[model samples]
Target: MMKKTDGEKNKFSLWLLAWPIFIEQFLQFLLGSVDTLMVSKISDNAVAVVGFSNQLFNALMTLFATVASGAGIVIAQKIGSRKDEEARTVAIIAFKVTTWIGVFLSILLIAIPAPIATMLQMPEELLPLAKIYISIVGGGMILTAMMSVLGTAIRNTGNTKGPMMIAVGMNIVHIILNYCFIFGAFGFPQWGLTGVAISTVTSRLLATVVLFLMFLGTFERKMGMKDFSIFDRKLFKEILTIGWPLGVNSGSWVFSQLAIFSFLAILGSSELAARTYMSTLESFCFLLGFSLALAAQIQIAHLYGAGKIKEAYKAVYRVLAIGLPLVIVNAFILVLFGGNVLSLFTKDQEILTICASLLWMNLLLQPGKMINMALGNSLNAVGDTRYTMIVSLIFMWLIATGCSYLYGVHLGWGIIAIYACMIVDEYIRGVLSFVRWRGRKYLRMKETELERESTKFTESFASPSM
Candidate 1:
């Protein structure tokens, strides 16, 4: 059913891999909307707290994601190399390490939620909710991290359906639980923001458990006690090599979001709510692009790790062709109905006014973000991560952050101004990504002496790096 190359382009199979990812992400994006809708009903403060805590939550996840990214790369490489037993070993190590990391990080996250929130300038009235929010979510952080490790492994091996199905089910669980806990339905105590957090954790735990079991049952490269043997220092090192850069890249760049969100909070609760709603809505439109990018990374990694350089390049181009058109359409919708979409979030007149203007920028942002995200992830998949690190620091930190500050805080242009700056930055970074991909910089870098062997492919198939 899943062919190595259909018509030498393999476009259909590639899209098949990508589409399930789209469903998975779309489902996940819906959960973000769920948070905004449920919390916004509570208060703008509730919305801000959810957004704020989530940024920190993403930050915490990056720790595990970094290592999981490495594990995924290893899985790709090993599978491409036909080193099935080794891939299983790498998966076991990755999951165990991630689980332990999650446990430790959860402690720190719970202990210092307030201090972090304070540094982000949480309003006094909102601080308590933020604390509760972080605590509940943080308790389940390990489950989230474990899921990423296992999920990435599954995706690396070309099994996309389970994850998407799990997500659809999880989102439904999340929403049902959200209603029960948030409103204190069916004898449940009303916990408001904290209830949302509880639902989130519970859902994640369910997903992680299911995926873990699937890992054992589905794969030829099964996880057993051998992979978890702590004495296997070499396996851990291999996972770290692929994972660290990804972790740092994700961590360093995403922290910029944290900074931006903090700035929004300072603008007032209404503005924060608007920004939160905008982000949630934007997720739906961009998720297809994100799914394509993820698929590209997996496919490219498989090819490159198998030494199929030409195929890797060809695969990425196909990914762009399919993903770009979708982005354009999604962005156009945002441009056309920005106001109406803003209306869905709130009735606050002040927020509606600010968000309405901000929606236009989503047109520019959607495409640009898609470009950079595709290029960046594809490059990283092939182990050319240094380029992403340098590029992200320049654009995400220097340009995006600078313009945001100049417009939002320094120039007093408000939230719209901040978003305008964000759109500009996205455009710049997106163009950079396109240029790099077209020039084949990442491909050449992957072909370099030290790493070229990491990517290998052939007629039947190829193994991605492990």
Candidate 2:
């Protein structure tokens, strides 16, 4: 095999790695859209019930996501070091962590789904629908959690395509099942909210099985308690050293968003509907940037792990350069075409208009958002997650969350005003990230040197430019 050179980015190869992620994310992105549509067909109240209740899942996932999300950096490093066994071990630990977390979440949510509904002050008209949606979705949280960790491991190992294909298949199955079960098509029972839940759980179960079977039958990899016991004390320190900062960074940012969501819940049911639809649209709109960000991380983590700091530096910007333009273009698509897109989610003219207005707001915010995503992911990939955590805390908590609270709740300026605060927050973080990159604060000497030496050869390769 030919040697790989430092700082060399095969745009094609990077995209090849990224396309599967893009497709995976695309299908995953459609999840909310599909669920929203399926339940909306049952009733507008069902839509709110389903939408509001999803926060519980998000809140639960937040606690355990680091187990999975932190695995990618470690896996990428192992691959760069050519230590597939270690990568496999990390994957096993991650699986165990999330599996238990999922099981607990399933029990907790199922036990108290009703109380959660009441706590959210969920629209009374939609409480029953909410209960059923929460019961089914929360009951099956284990399956979804399995899907998340394993999928992240799969993607991290440079085998994204298989999972993407499985995601597409499962998505199609879910949509079809939803149609049949929700409306009683094809002689299926017309179960409405319960039907949608059944379809979702069943599809997620299939996705988990397919992913596991792929490892067993195709990849021939098995993870268990034995594998988890092969602990890497050093790597554990490394993982947490880098991963915990990232966890804090990501948590701060996400919590801020959740806080804003909570604020909107108070505005009224219609506001909640508008926020949900806008959020769904934003999910799709943001996919391009996220996929590209994943590509950047994979590229940066591998190249940097292989002691190619110079190339890693160039790679981050190259990936960002490619993604930044796409973000701008996608925003325009949302601006020009958002009306038609939101219409697919709702028949309510007023709700449709609210979503459209929100889409335009998103378009204006995309450039800033793109900068933040590109820089943040790239920075974290290099294990400089402390910066991410600190900056995110400073900005998200004090600036973003505070601005959102004062305007949205205190001033009673409503959802649009709330978003205006968010736009400011996005740009502020975006600019700060850009500035951090220029100052090299995101890539300090200690982490870079440690990473470089980890894979650096005492003896050089024959071809420096391989």
Candidate with the greatest lDDT versus the true structure:
1
**RMSD list, candidates in order:** 5.0, 4.2
* Model 2 poorest ten-residue lDDT run: 3-12
Task: Judge candidate 2 at residue 264 and give its lDDT.
Answer: 73
lDDT of 1 by residue, 85-108 (tens): 777778887878888999998888
lDDT at 342, model 1? 65
TM-score, structure 2 vs. true: 0.89
User: How many steric overlaps are in each model, in order?
Assistant: 23, 2
Best by TM-score: 1
Model 2, range 422-457, lDDT digits (tens) per residue? 888788887877787777654467456765765576
Give TM-scores for every candidate, taking all chains together and pairing residue i with residue i.
Answer: 0.90, 0.89
